[model samples]
Target: MIYKVFYQPKPEQVPVRENTESFYVEASSEREARKILADKNISIEFVQQISGVFLEYEKQNLNFKVEQG
Candidate 1:
């Protein structure tokens, strides 16, 4: 199956929009599809398998924070 991944890398840049990209990857299964892109440091927003429904995964939380005591 071919999965189209829409993602924006971490530490996203600037006020301009266009932060995400659509990439097509061929894989055997949904899990495999995710693994393929994971290697590239791409933060997935949505991934829809070509000719099929979107694949779901655990949402990632990567917020930066600072604490003072």
Candidate 2:
């Protein structure tokens, strides 16, 4: 099962000179993913299991279309 991990710094934690992105990761299992994050010294504040995947599409709107279909 895939999981979404949210990492937030602790109130009393000291700053580290590392670049940790505030995002999520998908893994085979929650426990494995947590271990990976811990190995990187990242504290996971929250973890949510994702039931399935989602897709999104986007397009830009322009004025000069010349009677676009």
Candidate 3:
């Protein structure tokens, strides 16, 4: 499965709507995805599982690439 991770670069900083960063990770589950990012020290806002129509839409984006952790 693929997950969309929304986060801020620093743990102490608040996420701004326009400044938030995101990436896609391939993991077996949401918990596994969170665990994979634990060492990065970023402030995680959301970990969403992507599939079906939404996954297809994301695939159309040029920047959509899943990171292998």
Ranking by lDDT: 3, 1, 2
Estimate the lDDT of model 2: 0.48
Q: Compute the lDDT of residue 56 as modeled in candidate 2.
A: 15
Among residues 3 or more apart in sequence or in different chains, the pairs in candidate 3 whose N, CA or C atoms overlap within 3 Å are: none
lDDT of 3 by residue, 33-67 (tens): 99999999899999999999999999999999999
Clash count per candidate: 0, 0, 0
Per-residue CA lDDT of model 1 for 1-69, tens digit only, reads 556667777635532247775666677776877776666765678777655323222112132121111
Top candidate, metric TM-score: 3
Please give the TM-score that candidate 3 achieves against the real structure: 0.90
What's the lDDT for residue 42 in model 1?
Answer: 56
User: What is the model-wide C-alpha lDDT for candidate 1?
Assistant: 0.57
Model 2: ten consecutive residues of lowest lDDT: 55-64
- What value does the lDDT take at residue 45 in candidate 3? 93
